[model samples]
Target: MPDHVWWKRGVIYEIYARSFQDSNGDGVGDLAGIRQRLDYLAWLGVEAIWISPIYPSPMADFGYDISDYCAIDPLFGSLDDFDVLLEDAHRRGLKVVLDYVPNHTSDRHPWFAESRSSRDNPRRDWYIWKDPAPGGGPPNNWISNFGGSAWQFDEATGQYYYHAFLREQPDLNWRNPDVRAAMHEALRFWLRRGVDGFRVDVMWHLAKSAAFLDDPVNPAYAEGAPDNQRILQVNSTDQPEVHAFVHGIRSVIDEFEDRVLIGEIYLPVERLVAYYGDNLGGAHLPFNFQLIHATWSAPALGRLIEEYEAAIPEGGWPNWVLGNHDQSRIASRVGAAQARVAAMLLLTLRGTPTIYYGDEIGMTDVPVSGEDIRDPWSLNEPGIGVGRDPQRTPMQWSARPFAGFSRGRPWLPLGRDFQTANVETLREDPQSILNLYRNLCALRTEWKALRVGAMKMHRAEGDLLIFERAVDDERLLVCLNLGAEARQAELPAGLGRWRALLSTVSARNAGNNVEFEDTVQLHPDEGLVAVLTA
Candidate 1:
């Protein structure tokens, strides 16, 4: 590993849309708002910030539908605001990685607008288009991630346009050399600016099957999953050709020093590791989401840890992600009592750890009223009860009205109980979860063992979680008592006197006695880290 792999050894805080902070009295969050809060983020001890899509869009998919890949939306702020954001972020030593959606563009995008103008248009091939099938319907039966057929009919062109997500978000024709060149140019524009990296959106969806044959039906979803259960073959989406395109992206990033690329993919471990490319050249890191899937149990987490360690590439940097914009916050996923323990695990894990924006304050998901629904997922899957609105609510900065997020009405409702779960209140209480995160990040930044160490999973028994983080001469043991009652974790032989480094509960260390198996008992939902005293 490079001595200064800035991204590998730091904490990345993710900020979501319509939340964060509103600079424009207009309720929605903008880049200028993020710039104003750069000091707060720097104080939080984060190394970088990963922002969700802020490009110009129709807001059909909440900024994921990019109408213009290179421009900041008027709703968010102007291009000057973005330049200021980049400058301020670098001044504070915080690198910025914006979300890049290359898989598709909004139907309202000029490229698509021109492509769909007429069948005879020169740019018609810029997007995926096909003639209707023999039955005068979609050429192939491929289902959209949201719902229904992936093909949308264009009466003007008398043809069907491919859309992997919403009908408004048409898939770009990557097969077209001009399309690939244009996308590369968009990436270059950002790289030439002071931006450090990119978090590629839905990367695997960029390559489609050349065959364009009808997908095989999914027996598991024969009755069909609640959303859109039409076509089951995701095989058509993730093709081997995708690797070549990712390598091309890597080549572009190679032109700049310290530029990183990360992808959002949720496949099995074997498939997920492939995104790293040959010898760690493709994406710097494909986000590992084990924490999101693991149940809050010692055994479940233990198994996941082992699997993750085994799955990483040789000499490849590993990354751990607890929560992001798409899923529910970790605090809400695991109960409030267990929030601190989750933080300990995240900070101690041997990789770059990403914390969702409001997770430090133990923010819970807000309930969105039926009349206030903004996400398309809810409308697509009305009965299944899965949507992103709850996770994308406005950040709670203070107990004051609007939670200091906005002076006007917010785009989404703010989290309830802001008086208790807010930055202002938690900053005063040293034992608050907010303080725990701050201290953890500080320690992580200072300690090499917890930063770039190799992790070893120790014995996990009877609701006790144990692990070792080691790099060169430094070694530390981490144990967590996840059960309702206090319990002791057995320590390894030859382990001598240990000093308490960080703990959720009181810092009382019972020595490493062989008779007690070098153990210390911890209270319910408590976690502890101890470094060997030489």
Candidate 2:
């Protein structure tokens, strides 16, 4: 693999800034804290670190509502601290990817403040503002993803401003050339600071319908589903114009050699591939969340992989994700035992894989009660259970007070099992999840087949999932059992012998001396990668 384009062949580890570590004893993680832990990340064998949004904000939506794109939040650290973190990360051979939120900005952002001040203000067009409908309500029936109407009335101006999320976050009018140029400049700002790339937040929401038409009701929406899902969002999101806007952003990223543009798009595989804009003008990797939403069954997962592999554009690369800041932890979604299987599946896939922070140690979601809830979505819709606070809790570094994540109380409570389920304890246990992840990553680096290979589904029967990954002369057979009982997979004719390279049960080389004649047996929830020795 060439070192020039690292993202295509490397695994990405996501670090939620406020929950990673705290250096100032302020209960919130900071850039300085992240900088201090560079050695640990380097040892983890990840090629890059993708930090969640750290821009200056009012803490609305936990920094997604950016007030200043160029400045680092005092809550995270000063700009100088960020520079040091970037320098240190580069020195350790770990590329840094910052979260870029271009869809909306904090209502307090200077541009929004000026735009909302009056109808005739020069910056009024910077944000999506419009006149009320004839009946004196919001301009349209679009609903915010958080809850309630998408439009928030400004008493002073008597017009409503559109927001796809919380009212405090006003969507930018990407149709306006000024807004486009300003956002592009924001990209240049970080590139000038020596950052490697950006993970664009809500890239699909960057453009909306010019007609401001009412979104049609979703026929399949359940009665108790999220209010935003009640509508089909035809006009509000995934518009054709979004592709052009993404191309512009990609152009700006191209100005900086080797820097990547990773768009956060949650569309179907067909539509998702469109973000890889016409060869060279789209996101280098549009995050693929199929595994996150797929059923845990072996057949379901196998079909998803096949569909995703087939959908990629000729030259566009593929990516996979199992967990992230906004979703439930993999350990929670599947059982703790299955999470090991998940780790194996994620790392050995054909394209790049992104590992969520704390997943290496099998971190489960921390319970957050009503009073403890900090997510705007949970607060806005009290009974819906849509809050992301549980998954955004502080990382478990040790058994010490606050899990050694901070000297002070963590911003969010630590998980109940943190004492035993932490990096410190897991690092010492060779059979631990952390060690499994480290071994898998090291193997991926050492083997060309696992790093950059062609994947083909070999079998998907009952609870067993089997596949082959190959590069040039090397071929690997991966078998996984998603069931609670032992399962056997029959090898094809002419596939002579095999040696266990890695297993979820830490049974490496358990069957090294045994030459296969027909079938292989897998223990319950066991997964293994083996080399064909014929």
**For residues 82-140, what per-residue lDDT tens digits would candidate 2 score against the true structure?**
89899999999999999999999999999998998889999999999889999899999
> Per-residue lDDT of 1-534 in model 1, one digit per residue for the tens?
584688988888899956999988899998888988899899889999998988899999989999998888888887888898999899999999988898899989999889999888888998888999988999988888887788999887789998888999999988788988899889999889877889888888888888788888866674436445555556557788888888888888889889889988877778888999987778888888889988889988888888877888887778888888878888888888798899999999888889999999999888886888888877876656567788888888899989988899999888878877888888888788888899899888767899887788887767888998888888888888878788876788777766777787644432332122377777788888877776
Clashing pairs in 2: 277-282
In model 1, how many backbone clashes occur?
A: 1
Error of 2 at 467 (Å): 0.6
Screening candidate 1 with a backbone cut-off below 3 angstroms (N, C-alpha, C), the clashing residue pairs are: 221-224
Q: Which ten residues in a row have the lowest lDDT in candidate 1?
A: 508-517
What's the number of clashes in each of the models? 1, 1
- Compared with the true structure, the alpha-carbon lDDT of candidate 1 equals 0.84
Model 1 misplacement above 4 A: 1-3, 222-224, 229-231, 506-517
Could you tell me how far off, in angstroms, the CA of residue 414 lies in candidate 1 after the best superposition? 1.2
